[model samples]
Every structure is written in structure tokens, then in C-alpha cells.
Target: MSALIPALERQPDKPALCFGDVVLSYAQLAGAAYALAGKLAGRGRVAVWATPTPHTALAVVAGVLAGVPVVPLNPRSGARELAHVLADSTPDVVCVAPETELPEAAAGLTTLTVTLAPPADAAPLARPEPGPDASAALIVYTSGTTGAPKGVVLSRRAVAATLDDVAEAWQWTGDDVLVHALPLFHVHGLILGVLGPLRRGGTLRHLGRFSVDGVTRALTEQGGTLLFGVPTMYHRLAESAGEDAALARALGGARLLVSGSAALPVYDHERIRSATGARVIERYGMSETLMNTSTRPDGPYRPGTVGVPLPGVDVRLVDDDGERVEADDGETVGEIQVRGPNLFTEYLHRPDATNGAFAGGWFRTGDVATRDADGFYRIVGRKSTDLIKSGGYKIGAGEIENALLEFPGVREAAVTGAPDPDLGERVVAWIVPADDAAPPDEAALTDHVAAQLAPHKRPREVRFVTELPRNDMGKVMKRELR
Candidate 1:
């Protein structure tokens, strides 16, 4: 309504959203949302059971339309985590689909069961004016890796700014149809995947669950132009495309292929490219900042880099002393700090956290990265877990993991620092062998890493595992590894 998502009015009859067999046009989606909005008007804050269904999307739109801040609860969260979020956010009501069975923590809240479609006899309501652009629109919670999850308060201005910036960077337009199977709880899925298409006046087809067949059908048979996914999905496609001819052809036919939420390994990037002739566009951002950088639709699809900053976003790298790391060699890594309109307003009600997040108006992102001479930024790892300090050298765990994946017998790799007497920290690798019967020998893996990277960066010890611990977004939980 604030030009945040002009598609609802601009292309009223065009296909807007699809989940399963139900396809809702812009008119239908808006009508349902407006009807629900009239019911929820003046409600303070609302919690949404963030399922990947049209009902969830409609409820979110309805809450925003009614000028209530929407808080999306992760369906996978445990009771303690759910309790913490409900207590911290203090939502007045919770909206859910008819089929959703919410956990015990949300049982006592005022619940509203959203219908799948609009009622036939209901009269069309007058379009309401939008709320203030500076007002809070969404209160997204962060993963409680270190402590309890904190709600990140994002304004309507920030969300619109990010969507517009990325729209320019990626040549996104109303003619495109976006496809993804990501969860609707987090920024990657809810904000970017669901809201992005609506803002562009484009169509969104959500795969209820990710599968090679579903993605292929959407891209080929359904006129889907853009595909957004996490690395794990791409990895599966790469693995399947070698044998599935239609899947590879469908991937090549798509106008844009995007990967985010975590770094796509260099090996998977190459594999997908070689098989499908699709270059996966990688982007970087977090809950606090919606989107920072994205590889342009124009060119230069680098394997390990996330590309340059988006429009209206200012990015800088700072060393341990907080001085700028002004090298162009792309070897020196530093903590990324950003100043932009796309950043969240504050951590909801946590003044201490909100105050600590910004350094002189630039939000200090704990992610470590390197910048090339041409302004492209390559994320190395997170400073708290993946920056391995061994023998006076600051090593990025990502590069070493890439090196390990390049070796013949490694399926997946995760690197972290372990306490060492001689070195401050020694790089330890947790590996999933390509073949369990013939796991890669420690000596061979060590030699390969020493040759690919530096000797100091090689893993001091390697432990084989069936699989690495991952979060819902498919990010390796390095904190658990340590």
C-alpha cells in the first residue's frame, strides 16, 4: 500500500502467489487480505505461525495492512525457545492456518484461524491508507546461538528500501515469476522470497517441500523465471542433474538462479555450472540487515564471492583495532560493518543490545570477509566461530573447507578452531566422506589442504562424521562443532 508492494494494485488480475494447486491472483490475494485486515484492525502486535502456505502469506499481509507489527514464529522451535520468543515479543494475538497445530507455548494466546480464500458474498472493502513508513512492520527473531533469541525490529522504510535496491541489482520486474521452497519464518524466505515478488509485481510459486521434480516443473512447465534457494537445494540439484536430463534443461532455461542463507561451496557451484549451464547468484545479509550485497544479473558470477554492495548500502571492513582494512589484494580479512537504510531499526526492547550493535551509526556485522580491487566482497566466515587464529596467521575456515571439498573423497566439510598449546588455535576439520567404506586418509587430506592453502591453514586434526549439524536454513552450526 505504501508502494512497498505495488503489484497488488498495479496488476490486480495477474497471478500473484501459488502454493500447491491453489493459485491466487493479485485481486484475490488482496481481497482476502483486506477482508482479514478489517477483522484485525487496531490489534497491537500479532504472531504468525509461519507455514509455507497461502494462508500464512495472507495473514501476514492482513496484519501489515491493519498496521500491526507481525512476528513470525519458526515452526521448528522447541518449547523453551518458543517460550522465550512469546515472552519477549508479547504479541496480543496469533494467526494460524486451520491445519497448523502450534506448540504448547502459544496455546494460551488469542488465536485466529485464517481461511484459505475469500468468502464469495463478502463485499469489497475500500482500500485503506498505509501506515507510516518509519513504523515497525515486522519483528523477526534471531537464532539463539549464544543466548535467548532477540527480536530484530525492522521498519517499513528499511524493507521497501532493500526490496527496491535488490530489484535494481538483479533486474527484477513485474514479468518475472519467482520459485522457492524456503521456510517463511526467516528473512531469507519470508522477506526476500515471499515479499520480494509482490514488491516487483511478479508471481511467486512456493514449493511446499523442495524436490528436484517440483523445481524442474515450476521452471519449465509453469513459466517460472527466477529460482531462489539455499545451498543445500542446489547441492541436491547438482547431484541429481547428472542423471536427470529434464532437471538440467530446466535449470538452464531459467533467467536467474539465486542461492543464499549460507555460502554455496565452491565445488557445488562448479558442479551445477558444468551440468546445468546456470551460474548461481550468491548474496550476503542477516536478520539485522535484510540484504547487503548480490551478484548482479549483468555478469561476473564468481564462485566464492557474494559480489558488491547493493544500492543505498555502505560497506566497510575493519580490523581488530577498529581501523579500516584498506588493502585491495583480497587477502586481508576484516569484520564487515555496514551503514544503510536497509538496516533494522533496533533490537526490540533490548536497549543494551541495540546500543551495542551500532559502531558510530554503522551496524557492526560479526561476519568476516575480504574485498577485491574491483569492490566485490567475499565472505570468509564468522569471526566468533570460523576465524581460526593459528601460529600468528588469521585463517578463514571457508577457504580450507573449499579446499577439502575440492579433494576427491570429501562430501561435506566444516572447519573450526580447537584449543592448542603451541598455536592459539589449531584448525580442526569435521568431514563427511564421499564413500564411508573408503574414507579419505588424514595424511592425504592434510597434504591436499597444505598444497591448496597454506601449511598453517591445514587442519591439524580431522574427524569423520556421517553428517554435520545444520540449522533450518542449512547453515552449519559451527558453535556446536566447537
Candidate 2:
């Protein structure tokens, strides 16, 4: 089994984690985590009230170090969702910051307040031998589409494999300091954003809350070389960069800027690139699969396409008949199926779901995409939600969304399919107008889409709204639209 973070012991004096003024050196971090790990030893599972703080990071690291699985509780989650996770995971203890207020759902649990700094009057940094890496290390739940969120069990082996794979792909190393304002829950923010830098032996400066000024401070003042954010954050940054010179320069000077969790609309991608001279590299991943593909640091600049499969991941597209779709015409869409060490072990207490999640050992992602001749994959949308079948053509909502985004009047757009009597499924577009008072009308939008794309792919219906329903990670809940 691979060590989750093999480089931690190598750098004792280097700054390992930072949030505002709360900085922990590698020695301090290891000491604190090891100390907490002792208290958490043999605990079946530990639930963390994941706040954007060093305390949250320390707690998660401690849980993994203790050979106990961690279940991150989203701080902003509703009481019902929190209750569901707590009941489902049934963690032995819940860890939170000292001043944090526990919700009604976490009322009856054993709570452990996390203290980051090594007890001043305590013993020296006494590190222990690493624990099991191949066992379940994290039980992250998915955003439920149909039912309650199902726990996706990820192993340390999988974490190590994916991080190393991403490190190789992104040319990441110990010297690269990363910056982001992502939440401490979810895969994008927690596993990748928080633990990723730790595994690389690099410093991560959390912005706490995302803002143009916060990003500027981290990038310009904190020696941060890399930036990780979701499309929503990027969209906001892109908007600000157009007028904020400092933000633009900081972004422009960064070594790499990465966006994930949702498709970065090509419009936003170009807006940032045009201003900052930095291309936003996108990646494809899920809760069950840590990360499968990414735009490599040395690869071509292909916005809208999550680059080729990583080193150890074997990715393929399969038709409805479970046949491989070999036509790399960049048009034939198929569900992405990936097999590698990066895959999760199973869904916790979910044998039936775990059984149906894979086909002959290959985990089915349920995401439809088209792989180009060059091996780059462009995600169309989720097969169950985002793929719109109109006029007998299998159309991906991504391209249509991108087309709609190109219009000057649109600020945000979401596409889905609606059942139609004649056309089986018709494309429906939900748009947030740039100027809501002077919003573009349906006829004009339909024409604009038809002109940009083909007439058949144009939205049959357009609905204007103030905002689209999005999750904590900024991914539009397309099922809500349908």
C-alpha cells in the first residue's frame, strides 16, 4: 500500500498548512495530527464538521493517521441533510473547532474540539509508523439525485494514487504553493485542495472565503504559484479581473490555474485567459473516482476538454449496449468508464448500490462524453440529466450552454431535456441574463443558439430566472431544472 503522504516527514521545518495567521509547520502539523490520532485510535469512524480552517484540516489528517475513516460534515448543510449523514455514517465522534456551534442533528454525538497548535507544555514531535493505507480512509457522500446521499468509501491507496497521478499531470511539486477559497467539505475542496498540497509537501493558503482581494492576497503576497477553484469562483474572478489589475496580474503570473467540479464555460475560460494570459486547465472527477483526467501542464491548451487520461487510469467510452465507442470523431458521445487504483473501495453499507455501480470490475461513472482522436475527453453532461435528445440527435448540453454563454446578454446558463410529445426529449435552456431588466427574449436566444450551433440543437424553450439552483461546489443541479 502506498503512503497517503510520503513526503511529510521529509520537511519538518517547512510550512505545511496556513489559514490567515494560523500556520503549521510540517513538524507542528505532524505532531498535532499524531497526538490527535492517539486519542482517536481504534475509533470506528470520526466525523468532522468541515469548516474552512486549519482545525478542520488537522482533524481530517488526524482521522486518516489514526487508521479511522473520516466523514466530512458540510458546515452549510441543512439540518435534514446533516441528520441523514450522521445517521448513515454513525461516526463514533464528531470533531469541530472550539467555538463552533453544533446543530440539532449533531446534538447527541460525542464532540471533540480540535486544537491546532501543539500543546505548548507538551512533548516533542513524536511521529508514529504510518497506519493502513488500503483500508477505508474517507466516506464522502454524493449530492443525492434521486434519494439520500450515498457514502462513497475512498481508501488511502486510492488517494495516494490519484494525488500522485495529478502531481505528475500538473507538474506539481514541493515548491509549488497552492491557493484557494474552496470549502473544506466535498472532494474538490477537501481531498484535492487541502490534502493535495499536503501530499505534495507544499503549503496551502486557504482564502477562508473567496474574494478578488483574497485571491490577490494569496497569489501576490503568499508566494502561491498555483490556483484551484471551481467554475463559479472562476466566473467571479474573471468578472473582477476585467477591472481589477492586481487580480489579473496575480492570476497571470501564477504557474497554473485549475478549475473543476463543473464545466468551466468556454466564455468564462476565454475571458480569464484574455485578461490574465493564463489558461484555466479543467479536470474530470467524481466522489467515487477521485480524479481521472486533467489538462496536463505541458499539454495543449484545450478549454472545455478535460485532458487525456492520467498515467495509471484506463478510460473508455461505452454505448448503451455496453459496447466500446472507438470512434474518436469528437462527436460520438458515450458514458465514461474508468478502471484504476484511484477508484473507491465501495459505498458504505450499500452493497446493492456498490453492485450496480460497476460492470465487470469497471466502475460506471454515468457521465457521457466524447473522446477526440487525440484522446482528450469533453464532457457532454450526465446521461440521466444533461444529455438532451432532440430531433433524433444526441446533443450534449455543454456545447449548447457554451453557445448560449457566448451571447453578450447571458450571465449564466443551464441546459436540460424535457419530454415532448413529438420529439421525445426537447432541449430547454434556463438563462440568467446579464441585465435582468433588459433580458434577452426567447425568440432572440433561440435564434442566437441556432446561429452559433445548428438549428436542431437550439433550445426549444428558454426560461429566464434570477439564478440557477447550485450546490455548495457551484455545480448547477440540472435535475431541479428538468
Candidate 3:
């Protein structure tokens, strides 16, 4: 209520959100959320079945209105993962849609069904004053690359701060219409894609499922000014743009295109730009820190960089010994560390992890990156998998992956470090070939990388596959490949 209440009050009848054909105006959304909040007033913490639907959005809003922490559960989560999350979070109530079936993992929890539309007697309640800075807002779980997923406890202040910073950076306002087709469980989708527009008093059109036709129609018909997507969605748009002028026209008409969660290949970037004349801006962030850096909406566009730090965010590159690594030259690889109000308070129930995550009050992000002379940041890869030391040289897998994507027959590529007695770590590539019948030979691919980058950076071993393992947000899982 403290954040989006002003928007709801100013534009009561304006359309606030849409999913497929179902639409909810500011007044209607307020009524439904208030009605639900009355029922869930004292619930300590609740879990919602976070799907790309309006009901999920309303449930979260109700929790916010009642000053309750919300935990979003991934709908696609397997039984064990879901069980682990439920056990870890221990939510008082599990919210679901009217006709939604609870997964087996939701057993033994008190369940509540959220109705999308407000009933006749529903009314908007007067919002209270802003809560304290320490009030928990959302408990978002990590991807669990190490072991079990850790629940990142984000405060209301952190969420509001990041959203406001993004609003200023993107020049977002009430007149703009935002379109996205992303799952709602993650920060990119629910926090930015959904709540950002509401905070700006802007309209949101959520394409239920991602499709070129859906994206084109939303951008053109809904007068959408901004679009948010991961690389997979953009890759599909780029592949379809050559044959679909309407899609290109739709993309070109938009004011901004953003890609995140993973690096958008330079190949896809070029393809989309060539077809639509719009460069997709990238951003760098993690679950712990909501958003640290982003490309400005009205600034010079760089294809590979994620632009400079956002307002109120401080970013630095540090070596293994915790000394600062100056990135003025732009080729030195160092781990990214950030200190800002946008950071999460802690990992729920894991005090040791929370303490270890911060170094002298700066959160140590495991992401490796470089900064150019102009202060633009380019993420190389993850420190665990992407940093490869071979032949006494520190190489980033992202640079080589970008180089491989430029070659003729490389569709999707993931580079990882494999143990080698000679090089200490040999660069091994797992590639999804463009064509099975005419796959690029390993020697030719190696030579291609050797030409684009240094010969020492070339992949020592290349394995061709039909597809690479990807997560819900479209990031390639390099740890799995290794």
C-alpha cells in the first residue's frame, strides 16, 4: 500500500494489469486486493502459487496490503524442490487460484483460493502509513547451484528502492504501457515486469505464454512503450523477425528493449538490431541484490555491456585477495562486488550464509565482469564456471561463447572449465549445432574461436548436442554441462 497506493488512488479507473483477455483496472485491483487483505490481515507469512496470471499478482498485492511477507513458489518446481521450499519457508497459508490444483508438495498447509475479479460488495480500503524498513516483503529462493536453494529475505524498502531507481533510469511514467511474457516467480518478472509498472501508475499487458505473435500484437495494439525479456524470448523474436515484418515494426516502435538473467549473445543482438534497428539493452543483477546496474534508456547503446551502475548503487571489481581491480582497460576479469540499499537483508533461517555473503558490508557477487573506460560494465560469466585458467592465462568463457555464436553453424553454446593435467583447466565447449546434418566440425569451430580471440582461448574440446540445458529464465546451466 505504501508503494503502489498512490498510483491506484490517482488513476482509479485506469487499466492496471492484463493477462491474456482478462483485464483489471486500478480501482478493481484495489478492491480485490483490499477484500482479500481483510481476510489475510494477521497471517504471518504466506506462499502463493506464482504463475504468469492475474490471480497470482492479486494474491501478492493482498499480502503487501496486509503487511505480510509473500513467498512465491515456482509452479514448475519438482516434488523434492517444492517440498524443500515449503519446509524451509514454513508459510502459514498457501494461496492458489480458484481452479488451481495444489502440487503434492503443498500437502498439510492451509490453502486459500484467490479470486481475480472483485465481487459486488468489495471496496477499496484506506491504506495505512508505510511500514518500517525492516519489514519483510518477499522471500525469494535462489537457483541453488551449490545445494539446496536459499530463501533470500527481501525487505519492502529494498524492493521499493530498486523499483524507483529503475523507474528513474528508464524514464518510466504513467502513460507508458509495459509488455512482457515471463514467469512470475523470479525478480525479473514479478518484481520488475509486474510491480514496476504499478509503481509508475503504468499499464501492464502480460502475454500468457511467450510467442512472436503475442509480443507483436501487444506492442502494436496495446500501445506498449517498453518490453522486458530474457535472451530466449529475444532469440525467438530474432529468428522470426526475418520473415515477419510486423514483428520488426512492433519492436522498432517500442521505446526500449531490455534483456537480462543471462547474457544476450552478440549474434542475437546483431540479428535483432539488423532486422528492427533497435538495440536490446542489458542489465546485471542477482537474487540477493535485486538490481545493481542497468543501461540508461536515453544513453548510447552498447551491445555486450550491461551499462553503468544504477542510481544509489555502488559497484566495484575485486581480485581474489579482496584488493580492487581497476577495469579502466576493460579486459581484466574480476568478481563484482556491490554495496547499496537495493540488497536483500538476509537469507531466511541461514544467518551464517547471510554473514558470509557480505564482505566489509559489500555483497560479493560471484559474477565476473569488466568495465570499459566509459564506465560500462560487461559481464564475462559466473566466477565458478566461466573463469577458466588455461596455459597460465585467465580467460572468460563469455567472450569465447560470444565469438562462437558469431560463427556460421553455431546455434547455442555454453563454455565451461574442465580439469586437465596439462592446462590445469581446459576450455571445453558444449554446443547445440545449427544443423544436425551439417554440424560445424570441432576443428573448424576451434579455429574460428582461435581467429576471433587469442589461440590460447580456443576450446580444446568441443561436444555437439541437440540442445543445452536451460533454466526457467533461459540461462544456460554450465555447471550441469561440466
**lDDT of each model, Cα atoms only?**
0.89, 0.89, 0.88
194-299 in candidate 3: lDDT tens per residue?
8889888999999989999999999998889899999999999999997899999999899989999999988899999999998898888888999999998689
Cα lDDT tens digits for candidate 2, 123-157: 32244534445468899999887689999999888
Task: Please estimate how well model 1 matches the true structure, expressed as its whole-model Cα lDDT.
Answer: 0.89
Per-candidate TM-scores read 0.98, 0.97, 0.98
Give per-model CA RMSD: 1.4, 1.8, 1.3
Compose the digit string of candidate 1's lDDT tens values, residues 378-453.
8998899988889999999999999999898899999999999999899999999999999999999988999988
Error of 3 at 377 (Å): 0.9
Model 1, residue 172: what's the lDDT?
91
**Count of backbone clashes, every candidate in sequence:** 0, 0, 0
Worst 10 residues of 3 by lDDT: 123-132
